[model samples]
Target: MSADTSSRSSRQDAFDPFLQPELFEGVRSRRIIAFIIDAFVITLLTLGASILVFILGVFTLGLGFLLYAILPVSVALIYAAFTLGGPSASTIGMRAMGLEMRLWYGAKPYPLLAAVHLLLFWFSISLLTPFVLLVSLFSDRKRLLHDLILGTVVINSAYHRAYTREHSAAA
Candidate 1:
């Protein structure tokens, strides 16, 4: 279902896991795998950034080397902001895994929200460790704590277009 942009409605009326089980199929597992892929991508990005910093340090006599301290987190947030917040509403890794993220009512998340989603995820992991993922185990929609807090849900991109206007009209 699309966002209820036609009018205001409670989030309770949003996508329901019970009603759209297909959307969440294998999501819990896919999410973990996706994270691995994204982490690898981020590592590569950080390495590239490190190279640039190294060159800059040479020019500045090591002043730029200080960037190394924040390079990883900076790359991660910028990566998530552009990819997850882009038109696809999924990161490169998430797209590879056939996953996408949507707001509770089915609208795509904007750049800022996507970035915050990542920050919240990091914050949760920092406070509770990776064990925070256990929250999804009990969630009907298989949403992690960051998702719940952001009112977002992850779903299989394979079915993303299945409920589009054309399909609904055909039905």
Candidate 2:
């Protein structure tokens, strides 16, 4: 579902997640730290894969440098697409950071939407524009433009699963 921009309802009722403020709170500084840790791990894996490709190229094959250039990007895109669309609904980095991805409906996204989200993320980061990073400053939930475009939200996975369990139990 799209963000509720209707004026007919009270603002508080517009966003379902807002009904439970604690869910949003988990996206704080701690998640950022968890993200950093995940990024480091992904980077290391990318580097190792690159090195292997390079060594293979050295053994009478010219595929090493090619892999060096393509592998990292591929790994990154695949990571983005799968995680954002997958059960966890976040990247490995996001997951490690205790964050998870969610659709506007508070559910997992379809694969196609996830792919688009991943593409937008890379394109935005590649541009390295100050405006992109600054979008969070103006956003109520600190979401980037790419996130807004996809109608995806990143919340703390730890918090989300717990919240889901508790709510389910109550129901």
Q: Could you tell me the TM-score of candidate 2?
A: 0.74
Q: How many backbone clashes can be found in candidate 1?
A: 0
Per-residue CA lDDT of model 1 for 1-171, tens digit only, reads: 457744556556556778778889999898889999999999999999999999998999989999999999999999999999999999988999999999998889999999999999989999987668888989999999989889999999888676665568988
Please give the distance, in angstroms, between residue 108's alpha carbon in candidate 1 and its true position after superposition.
Answer: 0.7
Model 2 backbone overlap count = 2
What TM-scores do the predictions have? 0.90, 0.74
Worst 10 residues of 2 by lDDT: 6-15
What's every prediction's RMSD, in angstroms?
Answer: 3.3, 4.6
Candidate 2 achieves a global lDDT of: 0.69
Pick the lDDT winner: 1
Q: Model 2, residue 128: what's the lDDT?
A: 61
